[model samples]
Target: MNLKNKIVTVIGLGNSGVNAANLLSDAGAVVRATDSQDTPATREAQAALEKRNIKVEIGGHTENFIKGSRLIVVSPGVKESSVALQWAKEHHITIISELELGFRFSKGRIIAVTGTNGKSTVTTLIGEILKSGGKDTVVCGNIGNSLCQEIARIKDDTWVVIEVSSFQLERIEKFRPEIALILNITDDHMDRYNNFNDYFSVKSKIFRNQTADDILILNYDAPYLRDLKKKTRSNVIFYSKKEGSSDAYVKDGWVTCVSEGKIRRIARISDIRLKGAHNLENVLASAIAGLRAGVREDSIGRTVKNFIGLEHRFETVDTIDGVEYVDDSKGTTVDSTCRALESCDRPVILIAGGRDKLSDYTVIRGILRERVRQVILIGEAKERIRSSLDGTVESIFADTMPQAVELAGRFAKGGEIVLLSPMCSSFDMFRDYKHRGEVFKEAVKKLKTRRVPI
Candidate 1:
């Protein structure tokens, strides 16, 4: 793992790529960073890399640089079909993800969480539980800060809780976590993957390098994970909302964990602040990981009670004229949007549609027909969504977020909810999900100023 004098090329120049380049440069490796687009963020990242004496190639990628390097580190955003990556493969150059690079140098034991949804919530909760138990914890990856950036801060006793994505998992070689949790995998990232099985295979790699001494937390109810006991050598632990054979499950209104014949109450269902059954699954998974990390049950329970949930994931914007507005911009997949729809108690005027992930929107047809009053569509997938939900629910097309909000507000009745739970990625319009959520909130604020009639 000695990087001194080694030639390294980092692709995509995003946060993770820049961090990887800087890390390699700091370790005396010759680093070259590349990206296709010269965005403001890319420029800032370029400047940082330049300050570290790392070479940067922006606006486009060069295959020669990647092929000639001793190693290539790819950002999660970089696709497998990239010409430079293809060249690197043909040349037999060692290519690894930023996460893998970080793991090679990280001093702490890793707790990695991966799923189509709920990775952030579960990862954050695990970090909180460990911290509450007076353990030094660092939470990173996919959620925001790159693991490579956090590598320098890792100490022997530190607990590194990571939120991993399938994209990052695809390129990992030996990035095995001491504790791995696969919350639940559904049809997601279909645009990137050829099919559902292809996506699942990539995600299942999180357990590939795990040994019998390591632990894997799985969803007992998810059919995909139920029979995966023989897939890895790790000791598998199960968490379920239903009363089933699992390490963690709700029993008599309390979430309990049973490991090695020892039973412990993690938290009461009424104590968790996060809404929805999906969140209950998240809590259960986190609690199991927390307990395995030696966190006290009281510490885990207290963290769950105080955890208010993440932004853009069922966050309440404001109520205007007895109508509630919820921003679930993180609901970028059909399964995630279905969870959001199911969580709402009141009738919904749903604002949905964005860049389609090749998702089957019909999966949520039953919920839409039963609960949603109307579906206001926006972005690239609007027509696809409208077509799939044409007879199931009333659908309207809007060109912008403001228009969508206004239209939803107009149709919303008193005690109704105007929810922005687009079942596709926000890349069709905004920079990402966070920007999309912010714009939706701003639109809601504008509605208040207009005094729009309900």
Candidate 2:
């Protein structure tokens, strides 16, 4: 772990990569960073890194720069197929993920959360529970700031709750969470991976380094995850919606946990503030992690009762002429959108389709036919979604977010819902999911003053 005067190359100059570069330089490494993008953000990052005397290259990568580095640190956004990474692999350079780099420098016990969905919610909630229990906690990784950004502040007793993606787990050598939670695995990031099993295998790496002393919390309900405990060395804790055979389960209308042969009630089903059954699963997983971390049962219950959830995931934007507009722009996969559709009690005018993830659009047909009255398609995968949902619901195309909002308002009647739950990634039309959610919200705000047919 001694980095003094060691050569290191960081791939991708995004938030994680920038932080990784600065951290490496601070650790006395001869840091060299590269990013394929040369946008304003990367330019700013480049200026900051140069000030620290870290050599940086943006707009493209060079094989020579990568070849000279003895070690390579990769940000999650950098693809495995990246030329620099491929070159490093070919040359037998030691490569690791940004998550692994941060883990090596971290002085805290980590509670890492990963899954296709609900990772942010569960990760943040665990931090809240630990904080309420009076534990020093820092929440970072995929949800908020990069883990490397918070590394210097974390102490030996600090509880680091990180939301890890499959990409972050790909290059780990010794990164292991003290408490690991995989919410559930479903169809996601299909384009980045060769197939579904490839994505699933990467996510399983989160616990590959965990030992018998560590805890691995998994969803007992997800068929793909039910038997995953056998693959890990960590002590497995199963959270389930069912009544029996789980460490955390719902029974007699209360969320209960069986710990040390004693049944502890965490919260009532009606007491959870977050909407959706998926969120209930998140709370269950968080509760188990909290108990394992020695968080008081009362603290766990209190946090779940008050946690309303993060923005852009089932957030009620506004009601225009009684037609409620909801923002679920964070739904970036077919499975997540189906869950969103399931959560809606009213008929929906669904705004979907973004950058395609190679998800099978037809899997959402049953939910669309059940709850959705219309589908407004946008982004690169609009035509594919339209074709997949052809017989299930009436589908239309909108050129922009505002147009989509207008079209939904025109077609939606009072008591109906206009839900922005894109079943694909947001990269096609927006900077990220947050940006996509903001645009959807702003469009809804603008539509409030315009009178539409009820």
Candidate 3:
């Protein structure tokens, strides 16, 4: 893995690419980074890379910059279909994901979590539990902070807890984690992947390099994952909300884990601070990984109990005139939004729609009928969502977040909820889900001010 005097090109000048370039430069690799677009953040990243003697090409990728490179490191955002990547392939240039590059340079064991949903929650929980048990833990990847940036900080005993995505997994080569958890895979990222099976295959790459000594945790509730035992050599463990017949399950009102032929209670169902059955699955998966990683039961319990959940995932913005405004902008798929809707006890006025992922919104028809009172649609996917949910629920279309919040506020009455759980990506309007969630919160805040008696 000696990178001295080697030529390397990094595709996509996002945070991960910039970090990769810097790390490669530090390792004495001559790095050239390229991106299709130039932004303020990318510019800052470019300047930082330039200080390290790394060349950066923005606005478009150039073939000359990619040619004769010893290796090409791809950021998750970059597609395999990119012309430069295709050229690299044709030229027999070694191309690896940023995840792989990070792993090659990092020391100690790694715990990687991947899934369509609940990756961040599970990754964070695992990091927290490990830290609580006195383990040196560094959490990074997809959640934020590229793994390459944290690789230098890894010590012999450090536990690298990373939230991996299918995009990252798609390009992985020898990027095996000591402990790998696939929370659940549903129809997601259809816009990027050709089909659902293609997406699932990319996710399965996470376990490709795992050996029998490693451990892999999966969701038993997902039928697609039930038969993955044959796919990997690693010891497979299943976590489910149902009782009995799994490595981790809820029985007698407690989240229990079967380890070393002994059943142990990790935490009570009521003790989990995060709402929803989906979160219960997250806790169960994390608890198994925690216990397997040598974290004490008390430490796992304490972490889960205290974990308030991540922002933008079922996050409560504020209560205005007895109506609760929940920001679930992280619900970037139909299944995620349905789970959010199912988790709610009160009737909801759901604010949904964004850049559609080619998801079948009809999958959540039953939940929409049972939980949602009225649906306020926004963003590019509004019409598609409305068409899918036309007869299932009452609908309203708004052009902006403020308009959506105002409309929801009008429809929402006392004891009801106004939820922003857009079942689509926020790229059409906002920079990302976090930005979308922030805007939704700001709009809700303004709604409160408007309704306040001066």
Q: Which stretches of candidate 2 lie over 4 Å from their true place?
A: 452-454
TM-score of each: 0.97, 0.98, 0.98
The deviation in Å at residue 273 for candidate 3 is: 1.3
Global local distance difference test of model 1: 0.91
Clashes of each: 0, 0, 0
In TM-score terms, candidate 2 sits at: 0.98
* Candidate 2 per-residue lDDT over residues 1-454, each given as its tens digit: 7988999999999999999998998899999999988999999999999999999999998889899788999999888789998999889999999999999999999999999999988988999999999999999999989989998899999999999999899999999899999888988888899998999999999999889999999899997897887888899989899977689998998999987788999999898889888888988999989999998788899999999999999999988788899999999989889889889999999999899988989999988889999899999999988888878888999999999999999999999999999988898899999999999999998888666546
Q: What stretches of model 1 exceed 4 Å from their correct place?
A: 452-454
Which residue pairs show backbone clashes in model 2? none
What is the TM-score (0 to 1) of candidate 1?
A: 0.97
Assess each prediction's global lDDT (C-alpha) against the native: 0.91, 0.92, 0.91
Candidate 3 regions with alpha-carbon error over 4 angstroms: none
By lDDT, the best candidate is 2
How far is each candidate from the true structure, as Cα RMSD in Å? 1.5, 1.5, 1.1
